[model samples]
Target: MALAGCGTINTVMREDGVAARELKSQKTYCQSIPRVYSGVSYNFCRLNGEPNPDGAFDGHLNFVPFVFVDSLISGILDTALLPYTIYRQSADGSIIIR
Candidate 1:
């Protein structure tokens, strides 16, 4: 498995150097934020005593499985997004539908 950056989900930025904002009222905008799973099995294995095995080498493979599973989950998050709903606050500090 090719290790890339440290696995942490971050806000994607726009061309204008501003963080992308997902407007809750807009279905299109809501559909753009991807869902991510927080799993750290790979990190756990690396913390333990386990050698990083090569692709062709046969040894005690500890983190590979977790890495592969995390990769698949990450891929799914990269593509799918769910809509979000929001409510506005009234002058009296009560939440009301805008």
Candidate 2:
């Protein structure tokens, strides 16, 4: 469970430089992302709309099931972090991906 969504864990939970590094490689069109349910949102952002310019499928189809499962786990984690996230959301606003 801990190993799942390693990228998500790095990008969402950690406030250190690790999150920056993790998000650096991702090609997301989102300008500002919500802190609540962020992991699921991140996953959906990657999976949203048509295939990216790089390829037809982007090779992510195979991972759809796994991604759904990860979303569930991430939702739980997000709920657990709600208090802190809510405060962060009010003070800092949404997380900027652009």
Candidate 3:
């Protein structure tokens, strides 16, 4: 049961590969912008969130915490960077953060 819900963010996003580029783009974009979504980006990258099937199982290790911890970290970061990021912009709160 726990393992089922661990796929929270992943399940919400389309897995047909089309969004890989966007996912990668968002991840890299956030990586350069701030450390707020770094954790979420790391998790997003873990999905090998790309169109290639080559590295599908690359990081096959268990990373279930990405669902919750990343969100928590991003929330804290977003709150801290409210001034710099501005009220209109949120560091990139991944679906898990919602």
Residue-wise C-alpha lDDT for candidate 3, range 1-98, written one tens digit per residue: 33322222232223323223334443332222223334344445544423334523223322445435655654555455545444323544332320
Residue-by-residue lDDT tens digits, candidate 2, 54-74: 544333431456667777877
lDDT of 1 by residue, 39-62 (tens): 132223222333444533332223
- Estimate the lDDT of model 2: 0.58
TM-score of each: 0.25, 0.66, 0.30
Q: Identify the runs in model 1 with alpha carbons over 4 angstroms from their true place.
A: 1-62, 81-98
RMSD of 2: 4.2
Q: Say which candidate scores most in lDDT.
A: 2
Weakest lDDT window of 10 consecutive positions for candidate 3: 4-13
Give lDDT: candidate 1, residue 30: 19
